[model samples]
Target: MTAAHRKIIHIDMDAFYASVEQLDFPELRNKPLAVGGSEIRGVISAASYEARKFGVRSAMSGKLAIKKCPELIFVKPRFDRYKEVSQQIRAIFLEYTDLVEPLSLDEAFLDVTINKKNLKSATNIAEEIRRKIFETTGLTASAGISVNKFLAKIASDYNKPNGQKTIRPEEIIPFLDALEIKRFFGVGKKTCEKMYHLGIFTGSDLRMKSIDFLEEHFGNSGLHFYQLARGISNSPVVPNRLPKSIGAERTFTENFTSIIPLQDKLKDVCEEVSIRLQKRNLSGKTLTLKIKYSDFTLQTKSTTLPYYISSYDLLLDTALDLLANSDLKTSVRLIGIQISNLNINQKKAEYVQLKFRF
Candidate 1:
């Protein structure tokens, strides 16, 4: 790998859903909590640290989670409120550098090799970002600083939840050697079992395996494993954190006809759009309604509002108005609503200056 002076930090919030629940409900503090569907068929979306200690985890069935931690408190998700906090935390990251890449509501990668503050050490930059996040959001985030994406991502997960780890270039080999096989990125349950059968149990064990041997066993994804084993990650920090358009659609168990039936389906679409818009912290100026006919033909009509809109009522009203303007044409099979003309993405001037001369 070519030498680089770049600094990248990966930050992940600790159990975002469960943390939010604790923040709102004082009773849930230090208790076992899982966030997701509260129903029998629902799965846990997030589990608090206390819940995790008892083997309860996100994506586990709520029933199974309760079996593990009999005292588990299940909470429904509040995406709108989560989005509000996401925006606040994001605002803090931007204070250091504009080259931030959000992976999800609770995680992001920031390239601060060249930042607004002209910080000399990436470690200090990470500390400041951590401090600012806690100050603004009342939540703690874990940070990992490294020269490349692979090391940085792994480092971030090392300490976790209100902690930070910095892996210097000189320490890369020792860090990789010390990690367990399961700790490697892209290696999950099934893969770990497979690796065990092949006598690959840790980073040192993986490094001794041949690249062609790995590819032969795991196919294309094996190439990623080979690079990760050597602590080589060339992925660039993508700076485009903007929505292309605000839209939502769904497939029904059965098709319907007429305005009344169609309106029922439209509600689901509008709700989805509102959730997406809130998550992206965006508003729209135009609403478009899409209709699909029984014959598989599709049509869409849109209307532009005079002002920017983020309110659920305004977005829903515009979508319904657009639907009312269109005819069934062919016994509508599906309907959807979309909002468009999104705001600019993250103020483009925030990107760090690339290092090498072209």
Candidate 2:
């Protein structure tokens, strides 16, 4: 359908990992709980709402999280359980529309313009989906309904924790105008700082800038900002989207200065990546090695091979070579390896534009 008339819904589970842990463990309910971290080392994968009140957040170091909330309880991640719940939620989405794009285990976008139920109201469909999710999995979900994926995704976060919001086409302009520049998708902290320096703090400020002006200052992303400020997004929701890359990494409990231990870690990471590639029946021509120093500085080295390879031995050899040629500026805190430029047969999905009266 036409970009302006498409019915998109973004569903995001509230504190997914932490919520799941609470649901499974009665003692964790209504407590400051964190998933996938420890008091000594590692990063938090998710933090419960209670923990969030204490300034605990996902990606925060476990040590810092513990300091922020001394009573915080940590739990290891259960990926298999999360996967099972995700499947159940996916089934619920498929019941209404096949045009579902899963962003992750806990969030997805559903295009219900031409749904299986032939539903006329996207908002109603979203509510039903949320209700069904709670009934089926005993988990609360929030939803955003809008004309396109970007608006829908943003609306989803407006009323979180088992709430839903709908942004009709008529409200699109004003909704985006008053929105904070930092809330715009793809605008990170660095970009926000740059925009702030330019006196662009909101979408309204962004809309006042010309494409040429934006492009001169922000490069190609300037055009993106200009379009987004005007409530324009044409990106479609693609189902069963193929991943662009596959990789694995690990953070050391203690920074390592020796090459032997770093090499051993790289080998383990390569093995993990190789296994993942094999599981997906995928291989890539490009390999990248990522290193994070003790000072939190990051470096990456990449090499493209003539042939695609997913073998563990090949990956280890290439990664080891990359590591050997790299400078060890400081003790290493984290290391990662990724394979991109994957070999996959891709088919373009065709879309027909049709304007809808909302």
C-alpha RMSD of each candidate structure in angstroms: 10.6, 8.3
lDDT for each of the candidates?
0.80, 0.92
Best by TM-score: 2
Candidate 2 lDDT for residue 206: 92
Identify the runs in model 2 with alpha carbons over 4 angstroms from their true place: 345-358
Clash list (residue pairs), candidate 1? none
Cα lDDT of model 2 by residue, 10-127, tens digit: 9999999999999999989999999987998888999999999999999998999999999999999999999999999999999998899999999999999999998899999999
Best by lDDT: 2
Tens-place lDDT digits, model 1, residues 129-240: 8888888877788989999777788889988878899999888878888799999877889999999999999898888888998999999977888888888888878877
What TM-score would each prediction reach against the true structure? Answer: 0.70, 0.94
